[model samples]
Target: MALLLTFGSYSALDGGSRPLEGNALDGAVHEAGFDHARVGEAWWVLLPVVRNRSGADVEVLDVRVLDLPAGLRAERYAAFDAEETGAPFLMVRDGGPEFPSGRYADRSGRPVRLEPGEVSRVYPAVKVRVTGEVLGEPSACRFTYARGADRFTQVLPCGFTLRLAA
Candidate 1:
């Protein structure tokens, strides 16, 4: 199957700043955007990739999964990859591979700095475990970053609707 262009809504949290873009967004990284098969039956690896369209370097400080569906639980956010550097390191939704240095670790503080026109190959392994029947749900994600010492938080619409194959 091919990837699907899915739309989702987002909101600010923890006093996060609003995004420069619109509320509705598509998962440009993964195929079909969100997941594949059921959660329990499979673990969907979310390789969240985004480019810095801005004319400045975006220092992504932290990323957090704001809300999730009932039956689906966020398991682990592990490892990241950068196209500039072919390597893997321990990473999470909040913690990603360190830029300029290309060092990967299991911590939630280091920021993923993306330069203008630069792409972040963030392979954040999200274990989507399905337990029960679930309806279409929205998964909000907050990305906090800095631009020349100016810190701003933008929320993205990473929601998805899960259903079994007929």
Candidate 2:
């Protein structure tokens, strides 16, 4: 089956001036750009950016990968940008020997506030690499974000097919 994208919304924070929950959006994942370059014998590079123009704070708690030629599944846990660190709460697996599973705080992470007639960037990442056999195989990336107690998921089909170097 073709990958699917779901959007939703949430209410404002309990003790803050911003909204904590997000509502389902009404569109698909807007593709910015993507590239896969063979860096090593079996290593591939990937970079993708997705955005949510939803009127509220969108929370992505988990991500599910599907619809690829091969059977590969990946789940990610994420939280809203921390009030102190200003980073999107994220949980990732498959870290190499150097760094295993741990929390990541983005240096550019910032609280996004929208006005009555304004738009802001929801999610932003320009460089990300996926290793193993998935580097060059046709695959799909489905992501989820979360708020106080609410969550939203969005799936984006890759523009270019993934493959290994010949």
Candidate 3:
């Protein structure tokens, strides 16, 4: 039992983030295209999957976008199990089947827990409603999680630049 406890503690302490292969979007700036005429239209800006490589479980506390540009507002954020639902950008829509049902209740004051070797996709969607041309530097998607009693934050450079299309 002592050995088992030590192993569990070691696994929990070894927790961190890993980039998904073929979808390594870190440091890549994606352009969020929005209609200039159509203001107040919301769109989902999805981030790449975050994988937990530890041997123990980790609880994701919060997810947010850092350094958002003017006119681009983050209305809400969510995390979904990548294995069950696939890509959130493709599966999630305003009136789609997965919009209101398939998402994990991470934002409902409950942290999403990920088992060892699990991958989850984070979405911090932006609401576009600007009169002038909106262009800004790349922003980052940050994820805060806890392993056992220790807290850690992983900042993924899933940058985004706003572009208004005619």
Candidate 4:
């Protein structure tokens, strides 16, 4: 079983709630039971899923976690694997999307184009580490992607929560 956290659905703050045209892409982060995560742990599981929710196809350049809480590191994986005896799991990696100048045009990786009504495969799991900070309260994960001429970020409420150790 899995517990998913959704902080809330929101467009890029700069856009000021402009209607998403072309069924803009919105997403959620899937995690294991929230209680299993504790403050001070170095890592937490994150499964990112992006959906094309508009009437037209949406081009997804890259999907990565942005605006991660301070002292937390963002790591991304390309796929998840299952073993014969172990539970289904993802091979976690270090680092998230790094672009020069924070400009949308500087993006270089292969872009993924999702047709309307399509969802991305959850693989190469994404995990965040609490490098430093007092994070007993739930932190936040802002999932951002580039589509067409726009970059949209949606933070699902309670979608990724960090708990204090008992």
Candidate 5:
């Protein structure tokens, strides 16, 4: 059985200028029945699902992750196969504020636009690595998606808790 991470209902803003309009996009971490304290290694993986329910083509800026804890590590993966399998993932980008566009933009360095019924995935892998002091515990991580001046925010459930390896 496949886990449904986000079931984003589509809407247009400013007479169809933006793809996702004012909270049309929603997100949640789909990992079920997993606890942190018993786990060993962990990764905060982010995957983008762009659904174009509108009749016309709409281009959307890639979603952004913000306010991450200092100790946790991050990485990104891009679509390899033309088919949106959401698989064969590879590390392509890193985390931080400077590269908000790195995770979601297309080859043209612009927001990825989709036609009707098209879906695309933007993957970012955040690994929890403890050197000396552990991350303590995983908390709710906040991420915001922006298109021009408008902004949308969502919280993904942290899959595993962070602690010292014993």
Candidate 6:
């Protein structure tokens, strides 16, 4: 039997002229795991794998983090095929152990292609520096993609939480 890992749910956030309300993503929670990041140091956290369940091939246009609390900044670093990479998904610095060989691709310059049933794991490098002890608020990510002539957006909670330490 094939193993399936469904860490987070996705919802269509398309077609709206008005800005999203403040509480739009309140219910979505990141349940995968947690980590402690030292203040002033950057860390890379693996986000939930994004699978192309759409019937057609989709081009992932962009990925952005939403609702991040103060003192934390997250940016998309790179993406790799989920099937080719194994976990311990936290990276302490650039070119860490989690970097995949030929399977790595940057999603910033060109859109990452995903055929139906293929999954891409996203890594967002984040930096946190705060006087607070812990951060418990959940942050979500918005993924924009184009399938054929149509463009779509989906939001899903990130997979891990970072507790800040000095």
TM-score of each: 0.56, 0.38, 0.59, 0.47, 0.42, 0.60
Whose TM-score is greatest here? 6
RMSD of 4: 9.8
In candidate 3, what are the lDDT values of residues 1-166, reduced to their tens digit? 0000000122223334532112111223345433332344454555534555667776656556777776566665654444444544532233335455334433324565656665544333333334345557446766555656655555667654445666
Error of 4 at 1 (Å): 27
Tens digit per residue, CA lDDT, model 5, 73-150: 444323222343235232212243422434433332244545545664543334333333444444454433443344
Clashes of each: 6, 20, 0, 16, 1, 0
TM-score for candidate 6, please give it. 0.60
User: Model 1, 115-159: lDDT tens per residue?
Assistant: 666666553445456666655564566555556434555566555
Which residue pairs collide, candidate 6? none
Off by over 4 Å in 3: 1-37, 80-86, 90-108, 121-132
lDDT of 6 by residue, 118-139 (tens): 6645333332333344456546
lDDT, model 4: 0.41
Pairs of residues at least 3 apart in sequence or in different chains that clash in candidate 1: 3-32, 4-32, 39-130, 40-130, 63-94, 79-91
Give lDDT: candidate 6, residue 126: 36
lDDT of each: 0.46, 0.35, 0.46, 0.41, 0.38, 0.46
User: Which is the winner by TM-score between candidate 1 and candidate 5?
Assistant: 1
State which candidate, 1 or 3, has the greater TM-score: 3
Off by over 4 Å in 2: 1-7, 10-47, 71-139, 164-166
- By TM-score, highest first, what's the ranking? 6, 3, 1, 4, 5, 2
